[model samples]
Target: MKVLIVEDDQFHSTFVQEALVEALPEVTEIVHAANGAIGEDEARRGEIDAIVMDLQMDQRNGIEAARSIWAERPQSRILFWSNYADDAYLRGIAHIVPEDSAYGYVLKTASRARLKLALRAVLVEGQIMVDREIHRLQRRGTSLRTRLDDSEFNVLIDLALGLQDKLIAERRGMSLRTVQNRLISLYEKLGVISEFDDEVTLNKRVRALNRALVTRTINIETLETAHRDLETWLAGR
Candidate 1:
């Protein structure tokens, strides 16, 4: 499979590429771009099979690049990584690589096995692994986002990528009822409880939850410490 890395930080880009190579050496080509503008250009070329991208950049930004990729290369799988595990970026990536069709979000503090599983999922069309913390937050959201399981969260993000629920179900092996339930739960948790209305309220609630999860004002050291312990345990294997 072919892969691309679009990140501004050279050290991070190289380190991620190296780790991915060690896990999957058969990667036919691994292209690296330092900014979103170039990444968008490479994506429009339609040669890449998969992408492992960064969330932040000086120009074009990962969110905008992801939007372009979704429109141009709907077939490719994507794995988005960032130090910030905020839902804003998570939802941003969902716009390109739907949860069911080979996509994931990982925090920089994630374990090696988590990264391994994320790449493997996109490559093999199995389950995409996201940051465990992100998963917890997805479940905590009050809107259509909270009702989704990890798999559903993946599909919902994929929906943000312009996929229909029917298509997402076929890709993820889930039923339509399952999908609707997830959406209902998400809306209730997100405080947009009026299912009858699909207006600005829903959008506002979603944005609020996404912001709460991603752009936090509180200390995350406790969560960071927990992740560190988990990483130590996983790497020991």
Candidate 2:
């Protein structure tokens, strides 16, 4: 397998090279680049099977580089390397990521075993394998333990994201009453009282949801059910 290592720091570049050498003996060639600009230039020039790329580079960041690469060669796997999880970036990438490849985000602080798992995940399964902390934080805030109904969660997320119920109703093809009931159930789960008027209470819930999205504090077990349901619902669109 051919690997391209893209990083700004020469030390990190060398370290990653050593790791790749340790991980795979049969790697035909391991090319190194100083930044995403060079990485992009090299990638567009030849046949690189995979990429190990850093996030914050002097040139274009890894995400933009990955986008450029994937746009040109969607079959090539790109592993995102970073020190910590940036929620905005994760959410952004997750929004646009094409399915069916081991496109992953792995923290540089992760164990070598985890690093190996990420690369192997790309080489082996097409499923994405994000690092444990990302998953942990995401699962932490997801509220999976609350047993929220899929439709209920969908309504809640839409509400929290400030989507109009009328639009949601139109989109979901549900009656206004059905939308209201879903909101009621969500509000009940969130401990919101029905008597309040004005946007204060709704604002608080929306803030909470934003925090949940940032911290991954929603319980994933239940969140996954709704997430999958909504993803399916949105798929046809």
Per-residue alpha-carbon lDDT of candidate 2 for residues 76-181, written as tens digits (9 for 90 to 100): 7878878756554465456445665458898888887778777767643555777888767645644554335657655665665456888678666789999988
Stretches of model 1 off by over 4 angstroms after superposition: 95-100, 137-237
The residue-by-residue lDDT of candidate 1 on 1-237, one tens digit each, is 778899999888878887788778768788998987899888778488888878777766666676678677666677878887565455445544643466778877777777776777765564566768777764564344343345545544444434566755655568987766665555454444654465434453344345334534111322332234335544774
Model 1 global lDDT (CA atoms, 0 to 1): 0.63
Cα RMSD (angstroms) for every candidate in the order listed: 13.6, 7.2
In order, the Cα lDDT scores of the candidates are: 0.63, 0.69
TM-score leader: 2
